[model samples]
Target: MRHRRITAALGAAALALGMVGAALAPAQAGGGHDDGPATSYTNPVTADFADTYADPAIIRGKDGWWYLYATSDPLVEGGEFGLMHVARSRDMVDWEYRGTILDEGSAPSWATDTSFFWAPDIRYVDGQYVLYFTVTDTELNAGDDSAIGAATAPTPEGPWTPVAEPVVPPRPDGGGFFWTFDPSMLADDDGSRYLYYGSYYGGLWVTELDPSGLRAVGEATQVAINDKFEGAYVLKRDGYYYLMASSANCCAGPSTGYSVFAGRSESPRGPFVDHEGVSLLDTRPGGTQVLVQNGNRWIGAGHHTVVSDLSGQDWIYYHAIDREEPWLSEPGGINRRPTLLDRLDWVDGWPVTRAGAGPSEGSQTGPVAGSLLGLTVEDPAEGRALRGSYRPDVDEQSGDHALVRGRVWTDEAAPEEVHVELDLRTRRTEPFLVRVGRGSNRIEVEVNPGERELHVEYGHGRFQEETTVPIPEEYDLSVWTALQVHVVEGQVHARLSESRLGDVIAEVGLELRPGILRSAPVELRGTGAHVDNLSVNAAHEPVAEMVAEPVRGEVLVEESFDDAELDGWEWVREDPAARVEDGALVWPLTGADLVGAGGSGGLLLREAPAGDWMVETKLTLDLGDTEVRNYQQAGLIVHADDDTFLRLGHVAIWNTRQVEFGKEVNQDGFLSWGGHTSGPPADTTWLRIHHTTNDAGEHLYRSAFSTDGESWRWGATWTLPAGSDARVGLYTGGGAQPETEAVFDHVRFYDAG
Candidate 1:
């Protein structure tokens, strides 16, 4: 259908069937320029520079800012992807990357250089900034047809213009055409508009538009069902009208479970249903979830876009996938898709996202949208920028401060892009600095909350350039957290939260060779801490400056069990109480679950050391929480027989607790299955896979994960069938109740160079 690209910063009196309409248009979203008071985020939400801000599409710019838009691929990683992305913010949680809206000398002179472009949507109607998108391929005829363009921008960071054709063309079919992919648009409070579009083979329609919303005037209709769904997104509320879309199989790495559902209908087009009434074109349809994947570290949470704020609430901004990194550099490539933001709520009338706990990972209460870009509230004891020991109070009545034995700079010498935010609490584990540029081209940063580390440095002292890292042991530091720091362009990222809305834990980056910094004196150093809100502004100019490389291979098979020897391994149902303590391998979980007829679970296979390899392990599995333990598993496999295989576990299913990554075949005769979802297992999770082959010969087996295996994240990719001899297993069992054990700790194996 519409694989998925997500984002949304909307509003404009939009509402439906239940009434409500017109009333948004006030949000500045981190685009209002963080003078901070509300806005406590968490969740990918474009983690400072697109790692993959897929199918998003925000829009909140009556000049206050917000604008987002994404889909063309890279803003990072090996680079070069397409020119469709755009970024801006002042509230959508502080973004800024902007470069891209059509290139190759401004594309769309009739599209068809293979035509690219994708998802998009944005809207602002009559006053300008329209957008819409999804061309895919065009040149008027031949195969890949796909259409629906349109553009026009006055500001949302666009030089835009587009629209000379395709407002919904190509329909064809058999000889190839159907996927006119995700578009969206809506409007109506009598002002009409409409648009929508299609996928999964000619399904989700809509039509109407015209008051210069760039064409598309007339019949169309349809609504949902063609092959389940595509990325639709409708909106309306109370009187109904909902719709939403996105279904399964989104870029399967680590077994993506692409979700989002919903149905409603008081009429934006026709009969939608769900909430039990079923029919989204029924065949087996039902819908009604509204962003899935709550097994944590986000999974393929569908393409979306909602927006409301200004105290009205709503929010949404979709695009997930980090079930262990999930793609962007080999392992079946390009899929990262960060950009997330939740809080949608609603309840009896539908709309869910956060209320149902779907994407959000921590730190909540945010989204007032925009209102603060005013600045200057200083106090630091009448500003001279403190120096050796410091003092000030505020915290509950204003900005805040308290450093104890050192620097605080920043009263005038700025520029280098800045964007700091310290909120402190620590008392002393030593290190503390923060400097940013100037003098000898700075970049310091000691930090050290009792060994959680973070020792940076950069061009001074003895020609510095240090490194370090770690910092996310739940970074306590006496409690009130929220670090942040973001020197743009030449890099120097930093994160570590707990309060600026919490749940970031750790983040780090560095760069700057000759690209050095220009305006320095931003300092902050400490020896006691408790600063609580030191802000430091001046940011918003990001066209590119991302990081994430991830390759690491080497070792070949380390094992590490410490005692009980199992030689080269080869069991299947062994379990004689399984032992080997000290270094791990415990094993217990048993309720025997091998899926279809091929049942019983114990496994342990071996023999598999060909080329491009990698294995990794570290299970744990306590499986207790909430209710029904219907699943209760363990992980790692890649066999070829037991009905063909591929596992990855950290299961529990019924009351949510995932890290799935399944794939059982045996198709023509029956078994076939599904799975995908990585990252977020913890209590000792750490899985890994990586076994390349590509170039079309297919072998591939990628999927990575970690909670503290020193920052990992990779995900997706799951092929096989290239000579197929596979082998490589490790198991435990589905649930049987109580006694759930499964320890493991190390199984290593690598050389995936």
Candidate 2:
């Protein structure tokens, strides 16, 4: 039995840092497993080097140090500022300032007296360092000019020389110039280069860059829409290219709602969409939120760069404003955006910061900060379980690697991250597999040469739909290929290389639920073809911790639904089908919603307790198992009006069932609505909305949800204008199928706990 990446019937699917810093691999990937060193780290990553460094870009220098660059800002309060800042670190935590890249003495000739540089993007191209940046205004043009410029450097800390002109000159838009900022460079598998740049005013775009990586060569294609996102960063993982951009107001003192979101496509030039398959260019744009404020002191977390530590773990470097000390000088002066770092985890094929914990406010385990793991097969091929007609070992060509004819499996361990690396003969029609679990719980990979694709399947006992990643055309399967698969806690990432130290030709990934691969075994299964150079390694399992939100204050106004008579509550639009029944409020779901187009759905509202108070609701609504239920929700809502309010509910959007805490406000001439999702739902979900006014008198609403009704996960915060009499109550709407209804047990208000 040639056990595939999974069972023959199904398929399955997948950190560290380095100290020579794995500069040998692409910036976003693992080099070879070269054990270097390990160290712990924490953030404000640049607190020791600078007071405010925003819109960061990072790269691993050839010298083995991780180099970081940031937007022009004062390094200290009321201190002299620089055009752009640079720093270097070995552990990715402790950093040393290497001084500014540009200043009065080193300013380019094309830069005007008032012009300045910002958002430095550093890349290693054609044996030298290439730097792309934003020029606020140039000597060649006037009237609101902002464009991207390029420079070349011999090293990370540079004596940089400017290119002839702006790589992407500012274009006129509505009497002014479109924002051409936040430059990021990419080199595709085909050897073509690209530059992504733009801002909230013009949208993010990707233009073909010349081989020099210093100039744009073709018309641009919009990847993200304007007025919603900016600060674009792109990453190629598995087989998809991800567009990660920041949304909301990036800077607004303590009120900043800035956050990060992501979309993905298979090509470098993308028709990208969020996790729900919603296009990024839609009027009601879709974005999978990746980073946000989790009720911590850190707010406005955005503009990030992604990197891998020596230990092969993925980490994101971003900037965040400390809510308590957001500004450096006067109130609402310059936002003190200290650099922060957090682990980036992939769940459901989408990226989320800190496994949905958001920004880190306390201490955290840092990167392994070390090289690529290498596995070797013994001459006698020891430990391999030979199944059926499989032979133990033989001299295939010059190496004495395992010659696989029938089937075999090897290497089992406890539930932890597992890394397997080996060389395989590719051209053969027979399939090869890398299994990371035993029994039913495991990830399986199938290398189908005929289809030129990798079929992946995963499960606890059963399995999921197979994900197919097409092989890159550049890959020549006739020769030996190095296959590296990393089975982390909840993700399976695999890449195929030309040789043991060759370029990665194709990559693919599959995300599984956590703990699926318990203390299991890593096995290699093959049919017909023989293999060699097999090695396996697993990390020491990590201890998991849970953070719970405390219940604020005593229960002030507890509304236990026990009778038909409801007191102190009024209906916005009465639904005849809804009534108090049994021991709960049994409200039949209505096929209606209250958003952009206005309200038709009924709402139950009650006067909110004065001062600061917390409101919570326990509800049960069967939206069925993961199915498309567009916005069908039932829970608590604090309504000021039909058009302006805040809602917390157990809602279904596409296949994802989550607790959505959303805010809708009538701004300008239309409605603006957005939300943040919290804890994964259960049969009985507990939703809470905390209310507190800031020093500016703005009413702040933060949400929390619990699956077990105890261990709560506090999520993002949304704000409302001060002095608004927002009533708090419950309702069920946005869906009107006869199959679903909400049973609300009670609505409780607590004073400050």
Candidate 3:
């Protein structure tokens, strides 16, 4: 997500070279299957390319290479280094990381070196590649200071030349309500061009562009409106114009409420309506929810672009935050936003994804046109499964004898053990065996016929162990060599022999654990691998028991803060200023800001549960002799996204301390309901927030406060738009006084049902 950071001191040239070297590092061996050429693909088409790339725009150049551009970083609080970054791919599946295309030194003279370059849309116009991008001031705040600019290059990869001036300059103070950013160009069939830009501040606006696409010509027109909208992309299909835009905050770590919504209009610029006939201008409910965050592994899936593959299948490209590997920054932490790809399907008259689901996780089929070999399997229990994108190839002679080449992804948490039995024959020495997992946490068994050796390697993270033994001469490599493998509880046991269920030539055991391995796919790799009957057995089990149960008329959590450990609560960001001390959750003020829109510095604790719930905590603000600032707050919060939340806290209004309640709906910015008392009962107060389903079936959040832990006075109630699950927690930050401290004596959660 978008979080401020301290810029790195590396020069542009040095940074470019380092990125090149990291991308060119040799890939791991025997990743999954080894077939002829790969034909299938999966998400993260570019694995481990880079950590932080967002607003992906990809295009196939005339040079037969695919080029991808995105918002690059030094992502400093007040420094902009590399603007637009580029990566190229020959097969569109494996991308080569090229460095930044535009740096601070090469940017337009009018643009400050600290301006944030975001969301560039490129298209070939009039035989030249035209690039339109958004630029914001050093703070990267969306306001009148944001502008849209253009550049041109003869080739997709180029030393681009920026236009003498910005194509769409920043508006004068209070000139317009909308923020002029996230520019997208559409080339109409009637020989007209248009540029679409805007954010939730005003609405989506479109204006006619000159044929060169270098400047705007006609008057701007409003086509769509939504208080939670950004990232406008248009696609013309049949006789309708599809306007796809992202709603809510796209970069709030795991708490992000980002999703792609769609509306259609007959004209390129006209009134747009969702499938439910709801106008885009309606604020009560948003546009049709097309794609949302699915699965716990990947969250915040939005800011997307749709493209057609060589085989005519539509694929959606976007960025998602990996929950396990969040990006840390100076002020806050951003969930690792990596580029991901998924097939887009057209069902009825609307766009649909796989199984009508959202972002994909684990293993999936690759694109249709790649050279990678694909394997498909069907079982009475597992149904139909297809795996693609195997990098190696088996010998031609081995392919003739090969009966089954299986590639399967295994969930480490499964209760049942996995067993595989196959056969291998070789005319020459080669590494042939089965592989489980990837990277540092991997397990493999290799049998080299020519070397007459058998080896087993297994590891967790960087620590690993390998055991090898000379192969018995009785094991014939010219004929079928039976192999059987059993994996359970992070351990693998393998036995190899000349015949099925015959005398074993070698037996090896390797220790591995599922916790370290995560969810890793298994691959049978090597040449001369011949097997008639390949058996894979894994008994099915229900997943509900493995996950936290939903809150249903039961006490979900109750922490007294007496124990110095945060067992059930997780920190949203790892800040040194926050800790458990003296039987309370103590968050000391660091003079950091985490109060305004998209602010940071607060210490937050999150717990995920479904259904109606209430979270209450006892907050005590201790500033000693120092005073609190207007933005400083300590309270209980029901945070849905950066802009959608309900906070009931002890806040300072114009330096006057008060117990205030506020709500930010649909990312339109925060609004206080003005139900504050003179102060927070001298320092200690009970803060309570409730999230429940109203009679109208809409999700509503309510806050209440009390001087003591018993009696309460209800504050304000706000309705939530339709979206994913939210997190409830206690927060303290944004205080002007660096010595201030907000202590939570106890926190409790109860099912409101």
Best by lDDT: 2
lDDT, candidate 1, 1-753, per-residue tens: 222322110111112111112111112222232233457777776787877878787865543356788877766776777668888876778788878888876667778885678888877554456687888888888777878887786666677888888888888876777888888876543445677878556668888877666888788888766654688878654345677787656665444667777787778887888676666765434566666664456667888877654333456787877755676763235677778887665545566665455676777656654322222223344355445567765443223456456766665665565556554567678777778787677887667887877666578434666666676442355645545555555556555443121123444455656567777656777776756435455543211211232376778768888857767888877877778899888888768877666677778878778878889888877776546586788888988777667888777655446576776665323454556544346657788887877655667676677757876655555676668887886887776687778888788888877
lDDT (tens digit, per residue) of candidate 2 on 149-256: 877877778788888788998888968888888898766555567788987777789999886778888789999766567788877654567888887666655555
Q: Tell me the spans in candidate 1 whose CA falls farther than 4 Å from its real position.
A: 1-38, 42-56, 63-90, 93-120, 123-127, 131-168, 171-176, 183-248, 251-297, 301-316, 320-339, 342-360, 364-536, 540-713, 716-753
* Candidate 3 weakest lDDT stretch, 10 residues: 19-28
TM-score of each: 0.32, 0.59, 0.48
**Candidate No. with top TM-score:** 2
User: Roughly what TM-score does model 1 have, to 2 decimal places?
Assistant: 0.32
What digit string (tens of lDDT, one per residue) describes model 3 on residues 259-310?
A: 6777778788867786656566543222554565533356567777765432
Span of ten consecutive residues with least summed lDDT in model 2: 1-10
Give residue 178's error in model 3 in angstroms.
Answer: 3.8
Q: Which one wins by lDDT: 2 or 3?
A: 2
lDDT score of residue 204 within candidate 1: 84
Question: When superposed on Cα atoms, how far off is each prediction in RMSD?
Answer: 23.1, 14.1, 22.1
